[model samples]
Target: MSAPTAQRSVLPPRPSYAAVLRVPHARRAFTAALTARLSYGTVSLALLLSVTRATGSYAVSGTVLSLFGAASVLLMPVRASLIDRHGPRRALPPMATLYGALLCLLAALTWRPGAPAALLATAAALAGAFTPPMGPTMRALWSELVHDRALLQRAYSLDGVAEELLYVSGPALIGVLAGLAPPACGLLLSALLIVAGACAFVTSPVMPGPRPAQAPHKRSVRPSGIPGLLAPVAVAGGVGLALSGLDLLVMAFTAQHAYDTALVPWILGALSAGSAVGGLLNGALPWRMPARTRLCCFAAALGLVIATTALAPDLWTLTAAMTLAGAFIAPALTTAYLLADELAPTDARTRAGAWVNAAVNAGSSTGALLTGLLIGAVPLGICFLLSGGVAVGTALVAGPRRRRYADRS
Candidate 1:
């Protein structure tokens, strides 16, 4: 071989997840972000238990949790835009502090048996309103910290896997703590986690510096809304809708088949386990396909798997199908994030990630609501098809149009 050709062949190997953490200050930043994000995982369960215990009314608890979730999910883009405008250092701390204080207030209100349901609901909503946007901020930081495209892909996969684990384990931790102490204690712990984590995270040298103050004479240019973002946002939302519906549908399936309801958790666990494994494998592969194309493929694959699950005659078959469907979840979301990063301007990166995050969450809420309504009135198999159909339809709508537009250009 020629010397130049030999030199190209000997170029350094691709970086691993370990290399992601080894980037200066990456570990500290990542750990702090995870610590704060865990609060999200724990807060819902803790709030549910606390409100239920205080009011002794399932109706009250459900309403309160609904309010909290709505406030948290709906406001993510607004909070993320604040981070984009002011930088994480300036924006995150204030949000975390207020969020923690509200959580603490909620803990106090729910500490005893008889706090008014109104007070509990108000505090919960306020706490959610102030919840910091840790995940988006961390993803944005990752883009800044790791410039190598291959290494960045690994970092995102590791981050997604770790986040999935955090959600799975966080509720379990809260469950144990609630068993040992008052459920209110779990709320307090969540408060502590967010405050400490956010404070530490913002102090990291890897964090972007504050946005320069704008002159009064000139208005800042806002992004022309969500044009380039339609594909990722729609795909992410579709995935969320399908996954969330799968949970309720599985429960309904068990009930209908007279199988043990206890098995639902195990089935769901399979889904999560498959996702974790798939995320790792996705990152490890050296893909020749464009990210947008890979994203559409992943979404389409998930939709097909989920749709096929409707035909499973037994719980075991359903579990296997769901596990297969889960394999595509992380890759789809990760690629959507990658595309969002590519499409967004630098100043709006945080908001772009937040839009995707918000879409997932909004779709999740809608899925659960709609799935709950359809389970009894509609056939179980039809319900599954509907859930899966959302994803397939989204992929079809978003995929070809972009390529056709490109061709015309």
Candidate 2:
């Protein structure tokens, strides 16, 4: 009996990005959820394209998409709050089911003529309102499954990589499907993918349940009340603003220019391809600076790369600059997410993530509108320069405060 000593429980070594799939239902759930996410860039674009065919007006289609985005942004925090309160098991399935059904309905309605624009907008709003809170759920799962900071960052990086890849694949898939048949066909497929994904995620046992903090910790934890949270949220918005501005600039360039009418995609693809590579490499690395430091460094590097894009006079130069600039985007965002996770109270995880998302949406919407207004009037290069300046300015202001926030923690 004396010889029998207790052996401490050591978690099987931290799972690498590849190994993350080995967790129970992780492969199935992640793959399914990915399909659901694929619907993201598809449905809205598909609707836009389909409606344009019907009414021959980009403005109407644009209005619908804008309204959907606004509706989604408004609902993210609310949906996340519900998930946090009720736990995913009880909450996610109903929302996903409703969302998928609404999308299917939207696709069906698009086939008919004389469907009022208001009715279409209402359907989109409903779909957006019910869209499943998958991103935050995935992040919360990673946080729960991987306790070590190093491994967790890897997880976030990997997640970031998937998101970048989606930028390519989502639109490509939608384009292909639409080209093959009706644009509504692409939306139909998107709905199916989302429904299938919802089924997979809802049934997954790996989902972390509601974790009510201990009494003492609960009293002390108020993630929104924390000192440094707003800074990262603001930076997230800035990132969105810059990216959207760049998007509009590319759109304007492609629309007006005859040589490469389709160049916008290639440009955006380069940006995403670079981001994918950066995210993977960043995750694979064993050594990393602190999240706050990484955030500032990545932001500054992004600033430099984006600023250089202003010098691009041709497609090659623009592509090269975009590729280089895009690399820093994912890494900076990864750091911001990690910081949010760190600073937020355990109970507030989903809502905190939602806030980050909302910031991005807000920034993207505002930036796109502003850039659209300015694109024809200004030298196109000025857009890149201004976006880069924003990034650089954000970094400079955040750097010292980042250190202070860490110290306070």
- lDDT for model 1: 0.88
Candidate 2 per-residue lDDT over residues 1-409, each given as its tens digit: 2333323334355448877666556677778677777777677678787767655677777887888788888788778877776777888888888887887777777775555788788988888888886777777777877777877878888887886677567777887887788777877887787777767776777776775743444323233554577767767777787787887777665655444757787788888888888887777776547766777788888877887777766777778888988888888787788888897777768777777778777888988888888777788778778878777777777774435354453
RMSD of candidates 1 onward, in order: 2.8, 5.2
Query: What's the lDDT for candidate 2?
Result: 0.75
Model 1 TM: 0.94
Residue-wise lDDT of candidate 1 within 1-409, one digit each (tens)? 9999999999997888888889999999999999999998898999999989988999999999999989998888889888988899999999999999999998898888998988888888888798898999999999999888888888889988899999999999999998899999999999999999999999998789755433422122232364578788889999889888888999999999999999999999999999999999998888888887888899989988998888999999999998998899889988888888888767777888888888899899999999999999989999989998999988888784445354453
> What are the runs in model 2 whose C-alpha is more than 4 Å off?
1-15, 213-223, 251-259, 402-409
Clashes per candidate (backbone, < 3 Å): 0, 0
Clashing pairs in 2: none
